[model samples]
Target chain A: MNVVDLIKSYGSKTVVKEVSFTVPKGKVLSLIGPNGAGKSTVMGMISRLIARDAGVIDFEGQDLTKWKSKELAKHLAILTQHNNVQMKLTVRELVAFGRFPYSGSRLTPEDNEMVDKAIAYMELQEYQDQYIDELSGGQRQRAYIAMVIAQDTEYVLLDEPTNNLDIYHATNLMRIARRLCDELGKTVILVLHEINYAAFYSDYICAFKNGRIAKFGPVEEVITKETLSEIYKVDFEIMNIGGKPLTIYY
Target chain B: MNRAKMHRRNVTRLALLAVMVLVAVVFYLLVNSHPEKPKLFQYILSLRLPTLLCMIIACISIGAATLIFQSIVNNRIVTPALLGMNSIYSFLHTAAVFVLGTGSTLFLNANLAFAVDLLTMGVVGTLIYWYLFKKTGHNVLYIMLIGTVLSSLFGSVQSAMIRVMDPNEYDALLGSLVADFNNINGEIILFATIMLLVLAFVLRRELGLLDVITMGRNQAINLGVDYDNVIRKLLFGVVLCMAVATATIGPVSFLGLIVANMSRQIFKTYKHSHLMVGASLMGMLALIGGQMISQHLFHFTVPVSTFVTIAGGIYFLYLLLFKKGAY
Candidate 1:
């Protein structure tokens, strides 16, 4: 997927301006930036969750806007932050909703098989019957991810998937994102606040600063202290951990 | 719980509610018929049947409307009554009597009045929802707030009109203001039933997406449900149902709130197909039981809405205080 010259403005304030990037297939790309840097806005625009004022997004050599929403949903799935499900839904019921794009409320045998696989993938088998509201934060996040997985889309977009999760669960989620690309050959995009997780788990990192791309390259090229300090407006020291660059900012 | 077990449980609960409705219907139909006076028994049955049909239609419409409205707004505490549809109904009747002197064709002709009321309410309600949603970018809270404000605005205007009007005109207007099961016209009931059937036919396809809508706007859109279009269609259906039921049998404010919540609590499921059915059954049971009690126990001294309002008010309080997070 390639996005060229994207622009979005809320009233008088332009949140995203002249942003451009290309996503490699079957690889993980993380959008990392400080608050108000337009990473999420870019993500939202890319997934068509938020309308763009001006842009051209080429998905498989076709304009993204030309793709029908239902047909596009078959190839791409997105999980936004703050998924507060108000209804009383079981884990199984929630995951089954992932098959809605295919079966639409009536889960065929194949849809059920995909739901089962997603449930097992998320390791939520024991809690499949448990109500979502009764689960812990991390478990509920996993259930949502499982739903996205069950969508069986080749391109997955996760906006701040690690929000409100503990470090252990956050790391676990990162590993799952890695496996989603490495094992399943799905292209994944993420909006992340933790730069280290982006460096360690993602193959490419796009850093946003003030609604424009500060740097976009491989992890090794973009995870340097100079680029981190320049983008975040803070001093940064870098250390190698597990053969990946980790940032220590002050 | 396993899926099969949950399915069985929901079915059993629905069956139990159905049986309760049946018992209420039978008791309502046969309890006071005098066997000694056969002619009187037949006359009473004839009188009672239309009222039964009106109550059934009103309850089903209110129940289904409330459930669907709640799902679209993604809120369990609200009902279509909050949209000021009932207030509009009362306001229209009061205005008609006040301006037209209670002798106009719109005031005296039940069928014509029913058509006018339904049309006015449906159009006005749809306009309010459509305009506000467009202006506010589909914010449910803004629509609800505007609805509450409009309700009070109409209520103030109606009461002001009622106070200065002739006592005879006020008396004529009183029947349409409060819900009265005994005085509904047979023709109006038939009209409402036909309108309801049309609405049911139009909304059958959209009703299938109610479960997806319960997941909220973003998820529904992500699942390719065409959130805005579906909401528009469903909200229009809600307006029609509310208008038809209110115009046919007057406005029963709290019945929808009571029945919809009770169904959700009992079924404990997100699928609106089950929720709508459960709510309709519970609504039928409530209306039938309330009418029976008003006839037999209270000897027609108390109106059925009195029972529903008081019970529903107390239940609303219980839901607010005790069942805060359960919904």
Candidate 2:
């Protein structure tokens, strides 16, 4: 995926401006920034959820806008931060919605296999028959991710996938995200508020400050004290946790 | 969908359909049972046919329209009546009576006035919603907000006109405003049936999309449904159905909400096909059953609207209080 000079504005306020980045195949790219830093906006633009004012997004050697939405769903999928649905759906039913673009909500054997595999991957097999609203915050988040996994696209973009998750589930989500890239060979992009999770799990970290990329590089390069303090405007201390650089901003 | 679960839901729906048909039969015979006139069969056909037809059309249109509207808006509590069709109808009726003194030919000729109501409200009401949907960028909340304001505006204007109007005219206006099964126009029923048929045909394939839509806008888009186009079309369909029912039957605002909620509660699935049929049957039952009660027990002294309003209002409160799940 390649994006150049991507721009989005609401009325007069430009939320995302001239953002540029590229993600290679089979890599995890983490977009990390504070609130109102435009990370989610950039993620939304790439997924085609939010329209862009001016930009060129190239996916798999074709312009993103040139692809039909249904055709695009075969190559890309997204899970927004808020996954609240008013319908009473089981986890299985919710996962089946992921196959809508392919089979139009009809479950062939292949679609059924994919749904089951996704549920297992997310460790949600025990809760497959449970209602989504009845699940805990972490479980619901996992179910949503499982749905995205069931979409089985080459490119998966998630905005704040770990928003309401506790620490253990949040870490598990990061591990699953990594496995999706390393094991399945899919390109993944995520907007994460937890800097440590991004620093630990992502191959590339694109930190944002004020609607623009402050730093974009390999994890080792972007997690430095200088960059972290500059991007977040906070006093930062770096510590090696499990031989990986983790930042502390308290 | 598990096999056993699907079978159970189907059986429940079938039972609902059976009840609707039975009630319809009773309603037909009940209305014509006591006629003491020559050419009794003709009296039954001519007199009761239009009322039955009107009830059926109102049931289908209002039931399906409300469910679809709730799906698109993602709110079970709000109905198409929130779009102010009733208020618009009231305002138009009051304005007519206020200006023409209720003795004009427009008031005397029921068919002409009914046509005028259907045409003006159909065209103008749909236009109002269409324009608002475009302006709000298909935001249901904003459309609903502006709709409430417009309804309030229409209500005030109607009340202001009613205040100065002659008492006799006010009495006539009140009768026209409340939904009455006996006051339907045959021509309007014919028009509504044709529209309903066309709508059903057009929506055959798209009805499946409602399950995805119930997931919410982003998921629908992710599922490759054209979120904007499909929603716009659905909104247009809802507006058309609502315009016909409100213009013809004078607006039973709560019938849709009542039946739709019941359908959702009973079906417990997201598929629109089942919900549409289930809600339609439930709506027919409500109208026919309520008509039976009002006509027989109350001797037609109580309006059908009174029964529906009280029952629907009570159910609405129940949903609000106990059913805290999503729409």
Candidate 3:
């Protein structure tokens, strides 16, 4: 999809301004920025979970606004920032909601299998019946991710999937995001605060500053000390460990 | 879902439904055997059948309606009572007398009163949901405030009318103020039953959407469900069903909270199909059981309204506590 200068405002207060980027069809693009840097806002607008005040989003060389919402949902799925689901559903039942576009109310056997697979993929096999509200923080976040992953879309947009998760589960989540691109050929776009994880697991890093793209390209280009210092305003030392750049700013 | 567990849950759900129906039917039989009700199906059908039908319909409709409503509101502790539907109902009855004068109210037909109440409340509810949620950028607080204000205005008008009416007529109106099976709207009962069944069926397709919705509106919309459209559709069904039930049974406000809470505890899931059916059955059981106690045991000739309110009131307190502690 090609996006040109995307901007979103809430009652005249601009949240995301003149953001421009192009997401390749089969790449993992990670957006790493400080909190309230319009990362989630950009994600929301791109996924059409919220409206944009300015800019154009084109999918498959067509305008995004022209596409019907259901059609858009088929192509892209979003795991939003607000992950508090008030429903008392189990992991499996919650995951089944991903197939709502294809299967309205009734759960066909095939849909059932997909839900099972999504649960298993999240490594939540044993806790499928456990109430999601009763699950641990990491487990619940994985459960939400599993639901979006089960949507079976070409592009998956996640806002802070690692939020509220422990180190192990957080790494596990980024690894899964990588696998979505490498194995399943689905384009994964995520907003993560931890820059090192983005540099480690992502094919590309898209940097945003004050609501616009500071830099957008390969991980090698975006993770450099010059760009990192420019974006974060912190003195950073970059080290290449296992061929991937790692930034340390204390 | 595994075959074994799925079968087990289905069996348990079926058993629960059967028990609820049994409670309703058995109590209904006892209530029908009263001195005022004649023997034989057709003879008893006049007074008791209508009462049975109205009670069952009101109980089920409001019960299931509140289940969906609470899910939409995303708070199990809040029911339609929080929406101020009940107080709005009393306001309508009292205002009609005060505004149109005693002559018109005295000559007013029972069915007509119910019809007017249903129509006016229906319009108000639709307007409230639309204006607050749709036009003003989906604000729930605005909706609640408007409803509360309208409820208070209606209540004050009704109270003033009561002070002016003849003491005997005032007593009669007050007596009918609280719902009882004795003063059943038989014609509207059939209408309500048909409306309940139809809405329930239509809402059945909406159950899965509701399950998705209970995940919260933003998540539901992200998953491809048209969140606003779906909410409007469900709320319309909710308003219609609640209005008919309330008008028919004379406002058993908190009955819904009790039944919805009971169902959730028994079967722990957010699936609307299970929640709706379960709550409806439980409501029927509670209504029937309460009526049985009032008739056979107390012989108090008192309306079953107090039992529903008191029981539901106590249950509401328990739910508030549950929300405070329970996850």
Candidate 4:
């Protein structure tokens, strides 16, 4: 997927300005930035949840806008940071919603198989029949991810998937995300606030500072002390942890 | 959360279904019963049959409209009444009486009057929703606020007109204002039934979409459902249902909120198929049950609307107290 000179503005204030990047297939790309730095906005635009003011997104040599939304659903799927559903649905039922584009809620044997596979993948089998509202924060987050995974899209985008998770759950989510790219050969894009997680699990990092891409490259090029301090306006010291760059900022 | 618990929930749904069927049977028997029995059965059938049909129409409209509206907005607390459709309806009723006089052809001809009501309310209803969308960018709270204000404005204007009209005319208008199945014209019931059927057929294909919509806008879009187009179509369906019902039977405000929430609690599912069916059954039961109580227990001294309000008001309060934060 390639985006060229993307621009998004709300009223007189421009949120994303002239951003360009390409996401290689079968790799994990992390978007790291501060709050209001346009990471989520860019993710939304790419997912077509938000319209772009200008630019082109080329997916499979076709303009993104030209692809029908249903067709796009088969290839690309997105999960926003805030997943608020006010309906009373159990975990199994919620995961089956991911099959809507394929069967429109009439679950075939294949759809049910995928739903069960996703439920087992997220290790949510115990909570599969539980109402989403009755689950803990971490469990609820996993249920949503399971829904996205069941969608079986080749390109997946998640915005801040670990907002309210504990350390163990957060690391578990990142590991699962890494396996989605490595074992499944699916391209993954994510917006992350934890620089350490971005450096640890991501193959590519795109750092945004003040609504513009400060730098975009491999993890080694984008997570250095100089780039980290300049983008975040914080003092940073880098340490080699398990042969990966980990930032120490106080 | 377990198989046993799931079984219990299913049992509750089955029990509710049984109760609805029992209530429907009782409603049919009661409507068919007459004091003269063998002699007056035909006379009673002529009168009560249309009234029964009218009751069905009201149930489908109010029940289906409220459930669909709440699902689209993803709020269990609010109904389409918040769109001020009921207020505009009352305004049209009062304005018709004041302008055409109670004895005039416009006021006395049920067919002409229903057409005027349906057309005016349908056009005005569409305009209000369109205006709200354009002005507020589909902000739920903003549209609700405007609807509340418009309701009060229509109420004040209607009261002012009623005050100036002849007392006899006001009395007749008052009878029309409070929803009662006894007074509905047979032609209007037939018309409403046809309209509701057409709407049902038109919306048959999109029934599952309502469930998707309850997942919120972003998720619905990501699932490949055309959010804006579906919403607009559903809004039109809502307006049509509300308009036809309001035109036939006067506005019953709390009934929808009461029954919709009850359906959700009983069904324990997000699927609109079950929710709509459950709510519609509850609506029919409430209207018929309330009518029976008012007719037999109170000897017709109290109106059915009074019974519905008292019962629905209590249920609303109970839900608010116990399930405060679900919305």
Candidate 5:
């Protein structure tokens, strides 16, 4: 659960330079940064979506790079920025895709159990049979999340999970992300633009600035007014509401 | 959207395929009895069997391959031809005739020339997949534009070569490309049939993979499917199938589009296995039906391709006008 010195460069330019951090098991790590700060790039490298120029990721004291893709997929799942599926699959069918890592294409009895559990976990049982395109943005997002949850991976990486979601669904998504770690004991690593959501829900924050990790610590240490102002280049006031830190930046 | 629905569609498709194969078999029997240059039945047999085989080969393979290509590209408008595969094939043919003289076009080693055509088309097909998909990361439009330009350039070069050829060879060259199935050699038909079967066997593993591929890259990769490998293999498979179809019966313009669109409407599922199996049957049905009517009903020796154009043309127009059809 520790990443040792990860670096990613994009052809004569380093999009994610020499970044390193660690995520303990059963904890949430939110990556926050301004646009084009390589937050997504780091997530891509960790999830093997984008190749790293130089890095070593030691998860459970094993080199992540050396792990077989199938094995890695079984332990980790990623929901990317755009889920432009080519098929008009139903929510249940889409969720079933998450089980592909456990077995090959054929879903096993165990896979079925996980798929059903994920569907229930996401509160999507009502819309399970509905076509994904026919669903509202929030419902579709939940379905996509359900698919990742069905992967049953130890860690789940999501990029801009709230892109098209309204506040109600966005908050629902953050709450579910926290519940995955607290109740299910899964590490949730996310790249999100919503600083307040990150501050409120995250146990730890890993802020990236210019392809580098600016700070990596508990939420209390990372979401301070000065740190928020530096990372986002915007003035912010940290207000604690119901004992949870909220960074109000306008 | 419905599991039962997909299964039902599959069953219906299988039944239709069975019926088409039975009809094709009956027609094959009828055509076999006719002889090469003799009385009505004998003359009919010689002409019809080749025509039957050629139509069957082009229709089924082109339809199936085009459906697969469209699935992988995630665009309904794209066909194997849009990849400039036919251009690579026809260009090679034109070049062979230009340099080797029209005599070389009919070389003693027909197998060698066929192999050359297949290999060249295969390479071009692979390159098209590699360049647009893997190398440049370009979209479908860029790929199509590049392919269209290349095809036009090759077509012009081919035409220029044809213009300069001696009038006597020109007649022979033009005649060869005209695709009168009666002129088909048994050996060529046999070769094409075997190739199709072999391709089917090889692509069996990829049939399911195509379904996941349409889900796009992130989901495919997250599911531990090697997206790049599967795409390359499938695209290559389409090229092989397309080359066989074209080399066997010249280019049947837009046959893939016709079959794919028809199958999508009928099946309503995005699985490649279903689409391919369904389209292959639809293609054979189209070909076989066209042949039967042309021989027994129309009473004219019209090419099967011509009949397909009428059907395909109408379907194409419907698809264009139907806004929801884009999905």
Candidate 6:
């Protein structure tokens, strides 16, 4: 996916301005930045959850805007943070909704197989019959990720999938993102707050600052102390951990 | 709940509602029949059949419309009546009587007035929904608020017109305003049935999207549902159904609320197909049962809406107090 000069503004205050980057296929890419730095906005634009004011997004050699919504959903799936489904849905039922784009409320055997596989992937088989409202925060988040996995898209965009999760579940979620890229051969884009998790899990890092791409490169290149300090406006010290650059900011 | 358990429960609930509707229909038709006088009984059956048909059509229209409306708005408490259809209905009737006078053809001809009411309410409701949704960027709260405001505006205008109107004309207007199954015209019932069936055929595809819509807009869009297009079409369908029901039997505000909420409570599922069927069945039972009481018990002295309002008002209060988060 190639994003060229994407711009978005909310009532004259531009949130994403002239941002340009290309995502590598079959790899995990993380967008990490300070609050209000337009990381989520860029992700939202790529997922078509929010409209772009001025830009060209070339996805698989076609303009993103020209792609029909239903058609695009086959190739891309997105999971935002606040999924407040007010209905009384079981975890299986919620996951089954992922096949709606394909079968539209009528699930074939193959669709049910996919749903079962997604639930198994997320280790949510025990809770498949439980109501979503009755689950814990971490369990519910896993249920949502299971739903997205059932979608079986080539590109998956997660906007802060770890929000409100504890350290154990957060780490688990990051590992799942890695497996999504490595095992499933899917391209993953994430908007993350914890720079450490991004540096650890993602193959590529695109740092944002004040609505612009501050740096876009491999994790080793973008996680350097100088780049980290410059993008986040803080002092940073980098340490090599298992050949990966980790940041310590003060 | 497990899938099998929930499915079984839904089936049981639906069967119960079906039986209730059947019992209501039987009592409505043959409760006080004079079997000894075969000719009189036949004559009474003829009178009751049209009224029963009218009630059934109105129930289906209101039930399905309310379920769809709640799904679109993603709220269980609010009904399609909040869209100001009822107010528009009352306003049109009062304006017709006040401006055209009771002696006018619009008032004298029941079919003509019914046609006018259905057309005006459908068009105006669609326009209001379209304009408000576009202007507010699909903010449902704003649309509902404006609907409430418009309802009060029309209500005040209607009352003002009523205050200065002649007593005889007011009497004429009163019969049309409150729900009355006693004086239903067979032709209007036939027209409403045809219109509803046509609407059902036209909106079948969109209706399938209602399950995803209950998850809200962003999720619906993410699931590859054409959010805006589907919503616009479904809301239009809702307006048409509301218009037909109100024009056919006048406004039975509480019937939709009662049946829809009861269906949701009983079924406890997110699928609109199940909910719609359950709601329509419950609506049939409520209206038929209420009509039976109004006819035999009250001797047609009380309108059916009175019983429905009292029952529905109590249920609404119960929902508000105890079942706040259940929906």
Best by TM-score: 1
Model 3: residues >4 Å from true position, as ranges?
B1-4, B31-45, B92-113, B130-154, B157-181, B201-204, B323-327
Looking at candidate 6 chain B, the ten consecutive residues that score lowest on lDDT are B178-187
- For model 2 the local lDDT of residue A215 reads 92
Clashing pairs in 2: none
Off by over 4 Å in 5: A1-5, A9-12, A59-65, B24-39, B99-106, B164-172, B178-186, B294-302, B310-314, B324-326
For B186-262, candidate 1 gives per-residue lDDT tens digits of 67877888888898888887888899888887788788777777888888888888877776677788899999998
User: Least accurate stretch of 10 residues (summed lDDT) in model 3 chain A?
Assistant: A80-89
On residues A1-250, what C-alpha lDDT tens digit does candidate 4 reach at each position? 9999999999999999999999878999999998888999999999988889999999989988898877888789898877777878899999999998899978999999999999999999988988999898888888988998899999989888888889998998899889889987889999999999999999999999778999999999998999999999999999999999999999
Report the error of model 5 at residue A178, Å. Answer: 1.4
Deviating ranges (above 4 Å) for candidate 2: B1-3, B30-38, B89-127, B130-143, B157-179, B325-327
- Find the 10 residues in a row with the least total lDDT in model 1 chain B: B176-185
- The DockQ score of candidate 5 comes to 0.58
B1-327: candidate 6 lDDT, tens digit per residue: 688889998998888888888888988899888878999999999989988888888889999999998888777878888667788778877887898888988778777888777777677777777778778875667878988998899999999999999999999888776656776646677778888888889889999889998988778888898888888888888888887787667778788989888888788899887888899898888788878878778888998888888988898889879988775
- What level of docking quality does candidate 1 show? medium
Off by over 4 Å in 6: B92-109, B134-141, B160-177, B183-186
Worst lDDT run of 10 residues, candidate 4 chain A, spans A79-88
User: Could you tell me the lDDT of residue B26 within candidate 2?
Assistant: 70
lDDT of 4 by residue, B1-327 (tens): 654576577667857775876766556656647756766877766766676667767777888899888877777877887667788888977897898888988778777777777777767777778677657865678878888998899999999998898999999878766555667656787778778888888977666688888898789889988777777777778888887777666677788888788888877888777677778778778777776777678777887777778887897788778888687
Q: What's the distance in Å from true for residue A23, model 3?
A: 1.4
Q: Write the per-residue lDDT of candidate 2 for residues A1-250, one digit (tens) a residue.
A: 8999998888899888899988867899999998998999888888888888999999888987788878898789898877778777889889888888899867899999999999998888889988888899888888988888899999888888888788898898889899999988899999999999999999899999899999999999999999999988899999999878998888
TM-score of each: 0.94, 0.90, 0.88, 0.91, 0.91, 0.92
- All candidates' lDDT scores? 0.87, 0.82, 0.77, 0.83, 0.78, 0.87
Angstrom error of the Cα, residue A243, model 4: value is 2.1
Candidate 3 CAPRI level: medium
Q: Per-residue lDDT for A125 in model 5? A: 88
User: A17-60, model 1: which lDDT tens digit per residue?
Assistant: 99999998899999999999999999988887888999899998
User: Clash totals for all models, in order?
Assistant: 0, 0, 0, 0, 3, 0
Question: Across residues A155-213, which tens digit of lDDT does each residue of candidate 5 receive?
Answer: 99998898888999999999999998998889999999998898889888999999888
Q: Model 5 in CAPRI terms: which quality?
A: medium
